[model samples]
Target: MSDLTGSTDINTANLPIIDYSRIEAFFFEKTAENVAENAKLLRAVNDVGFIYLKNHGITDEKMKQLFDYAKEFFSWPVSEKEKIESCESKFFHGWFSPERTSKTRIADQKEAFDIGDDSNLVRPNQWPADWPEFRTEMNYFFEKCHEIHLVLLGTFAETQGLPKDHFDSFVNEKDHFFRLLHYPATTPDSIGDRLRASPHTDYGTLTLLFNDNSGGLQIRGKDGQWLEVPPIPGYAIINIGDLLSRWFNGSLKSTEHRVVEPPPEWSKLDVEGRLPPRYALAWFGNPNRNAWIEPLSSCITAESPQRFEGVWAGKHVADRIAKLHKDGKAPEVWKDSMYREERPQQQQQQQHAQLPALA
Candidate 1:
């Protein structure tokens, strides 16, 4: 997550709700209607920088199971939870307690657990042996999410006036990350740092978020107002990230967003249970670890030259973690800036084939 400088004012103007049912048509077809869809996508990225995506083909039941596993894991006693605490792990990829993680330079007061594919970036994901269903559901979800991100990349590439596979070479064996985050409920009077996560842009390419009914996610609109991203049933929220912004030469936004206290209307507190905690599963789509995340040459011009240096994707991730983890933790393996280079070339190739270039 990028801790971007932004505003806290509420936006009256609405964010767009997009239907992804036509994604197949747009990614696979070269027709005029598909052209229109591509334009629609570009508009969302330029204007709101985020969209409510429906007809994404993920089942509500599966998402619910994902939540069930999250709740179960978090319900364990402190000692039990300590068995897999992030501070104890070499890669900092396990459970991070509420008060021990900072986002906006302040303790986020929310808990999270991160998982990623086995890679040179760190190591194999650590799964709780007792939670077999958790591993199965999460792995399944990650694979499905990978498919979604590929289509998204194609649309973005096509819209940026590049071949549909313009970004394909850089995306092989991507370092996709899945995280389970929870912001526990507090009485209105007891609310401390109301922002669960402070305003920040993600360091990755695309961020797909699945949230429960309890709403608090907010994004800074172009007008300098923060717009509420209420949870829309059956819709998974999608937003561009800093990597995409550079690729599009900032014509597309890496919108700044944060989780803050929801207005009363958006709150789903129960009188008996008091305030109920909010749970969300975020899938962060990143590029290959060795790929240099520099601005695309096609996107640069006489007026807008490259704005950022090429950051090795793996180093960018480790650097970000070193800054945010309250305990300042990172695996010793992460000390080297270019560890991915040590891996064999063929191992870096993706199991999936590169997407075909658009004609």
Candidate 2:
């Protein structure tokens, strides 16, 4: 059904690609005159669940600054990086170190850093006090994405034939997350699937990805093949997540993807000449802590009927992401079962204890 096999080596030339013009028209075009445009966009979302966005309105200069800062930050010594390692309460919502987990299906080949929302609102980012430019640029990039997230949410609501503000009411208190990922290449492991990132689906409303040209992003297509998502300058890869799919009654698909070790060509360079691993700036768009997510009356059908009831968007996403963080350093395992992780431990333990232990 939905492809989750997690293919590693991918051919980008033959993939089902979507450029910026199509995406721009999809978001900016009028409903009455350009109905076909909207339909095409939605159809893509339904089938592939991922699109390469072009002319998305985010600037190249801004992207450069963000990337520069990210590289600088990651280049810092391990001791310095540890200062911001996510605290227990912060969960996966803050800074994380490298080599935390062996690539999901393979050996230790990649390293990364991650940052997300502070549900408890207790963890402030560990800024490099000595580097004002780094701090300023990083924060700016984060804030900019947070703003773009609002617009994207509105666009999503419009796509569903709902009012522009449909998602606004539920997302007043947001739980969004911004992360910078680094994938360093290393020797291949047994299966050769050592992923800088494991195959998984995002847990929130949406994911906006700023991927570099060192391509490794792949999406599961309807053909049951893994399609490589090539990089588009100034374009963000947009995809629906699990919660959004349920909320839309499956109108949008949360395609599975992973980041694997680089191809042989890219991996062959001497240590000093090696092509640097991939860099991606990803944002997890979340709703307010108490936002209710339910299928709109128009999207619900007899066949789909209420696959998922109204869920508190913030609590739902936050709880699931936190558990994934708690389970391990990488976010892959967390995508396996949303329900079990979505519930808090206290409630889960109580539910388990209530079950017939003898059985």
Candidate 3:
């Protein structure tokens, strides 16, 4: 396995671009024509941990609408945007100013708004009150991304020699998150040594990311070098995450990646001599809160024994999220809330009675 720690350089790597139309066909039927395409996807992810997916069903017009909504939301006055700040929610589902997020000691230079499954009782989505259209459109886009996520999950299960529906039960509750990210224009000196987004691996099953052509994203290659991931219009960049890697016992990689300033040639400056702002949408796919995350039996072998102990999916993700906040802690309410299982009334009462007090 490649070392996960590294600093990024400007060298651009030629990443593969897979046509998802063929992969979609393979998902429905095992035809010879589309089989190779599926294999390409497996190879790309295993080798580089990232790939650009085209023809994935979401339209360019729809992507543009999402970007427009993000820009409008981020353009709101700081006070207005803070009305739904993440600090207000124990579940971290709301606006996060740049200062509130980081993967390292230096804070990131981007603001984000997070949306989770609306049906999640533990963390109902915190939507901007007045913008009904933003809510409507975001939900619409969220479902569209979920469709693609299902297809990819099925593909992964089949390719990994598990039943095609192996992951279905794990994701039935739709414990996922959608984020609107905006990296504001700023000069190099202003952000010295800091990045738009610090290097880190995602904490979920997989992530489907849509970005405007304004470039910045980079992925760490097996050679431990940072490779530029230029955005192709209408393409969603897909990558594995830590949970998926754990499930497969390191067979699929959850590579470290980050967003840096655009290359000099691609950099466009505004009147104040700052690079152009960049926007992106990311759909973070995760298993249900109650799901048990352990390596599939097939993934453990004589050569590669189980590398991780069993863990509850929700708690694992929540623990990682808590570290991103300034205080480095989740809300006290989150401790008892995330892993609660449904049960008979009497059993529920008994479980609650035995629970530990919140810190």
Predicted structure with the largest lDDT when compared to the true one:
3
Give per-candidate clash totals: 0, 3, 0
lDDT (Cα, tens digit) per residue for candidate 1, span 77-115:
767765677742456667777454443335564788887
Cα RMSD (Å) between model 3 and the true structure? 6.0
Mind giving the per-residue lDDT tens digits that candidate 3 earns over 281-352? 999999877677888888899999998766667666766676566533222222223343434653454344
Which one wins by lDDT: 1 or 2?
1
Candidate 3 regions with alpha-carbon error over 4 angstroms: 1-10, 100-105, 327-359
Clashing pairs in 1: none
Clashes (candidate 2): 3
Ranking by lDDT: 3, 1, 2
**Top TM-score model:** 3
Better of 1 and 2 by TM-score: 1
